[model samples]
Target: IQAFATLFQYGTFDRFPNLKFVVLESQAGWLGYLLDRMDAVFKGPMGATTDMKELPSTYFRRQCWISADPDERALANIIDYVGADRFFWASDYPHPDHTGDYIEALAELVAPLPSDTRHKILCGNVAGVYGLG
Candidate 1:
């Protein structure tokens, strides 16, 4: 599993530099685990040989976004760790697993964040990523 994780991490980003990837429904807590391992690999001998200019976590920090259901407590706890800029709130509406009234829930969840951060996550971030504006 360890080897596979390492290889998969490198391969995914390597193959898709322009890909605006978002991990949907994957709880945000796992992102910290992935980042830690990727950072470790970057500092180790394996990193020196890679074609990537920056550490894998660096790539993730800049290029990746993740969606979490509004009600996911684990996601709430880890939001700061992953950087709020890279997170998008998802209603997963009509899906049984998603909480109803996700917009309201998201508003509440992000209320304490800086206004700029809240504005970005609530709308501007997705718009920028998807080229909507």
Candidate 2:
């Protein structure tokens, strides 16, 4: 797990620069802490030194997406840091971990956001990310 974490921290999604990675079934609460730790480590002597032009979090914020299981508060906090463009809604339907009513749950989760942001989380963002549009 630690090794994968390190890889995730240092790896670049260069093969899919235009692609957005949506991490499903992973809780949103840890993202901020992880990003913070990654940034700290990158700036520290113990971390990898690469030719990348930005912080690790900046890369993640640019290329990653995540799904939360109705954990709106935690998700909202992450969005505040990474911006709403980096997240999307998932029903995880027929999966025991998610609320069965995925669409409604997404609606509720995005209720407080502006229309554009909600649109991104619900459809627009995923469409663009997956090249489905």
Best by TM-score: 2
Q: lDDT, candidate 2, residue 2?
A: 55
Candidate 2 lDDT by residue in tens digits, 25-58: 7667788888888788778875556544567787
Backbone Cα, N, C clashes tallied per candidate: 0, 0
Instruction: List residue ranges in candidate 2 displaced over 4 A.
Output: 1-4, 14-20, 48-53
Cα deviation in Å at residue 87, candidate 2? 0.6
Off by over 4 Å in 1: 1-8, 11-16, 48-51, 74-77
Cα displacement (angstroms), candidate 1, residue 39, comes to 0.7
The window of 10 residues in a row where model 2 has the poorest summed lDDT is: 1-10
Q: After the best TM-score superposition of candidate 2, give how far the Cα of residue 114 lies from its true spot, in angstroms.
A: 1.4
Question: For each candidate, what is the lDDT?
Answer: 0.72, 0.71
Extract clashing residue pairs from model 1: none
For 5-110, candidate 1 gives per-residue lDDT tens digits of: 5544456667777777767765565778877887898789987766666777777777788776677666545667777778877777788876577768887777
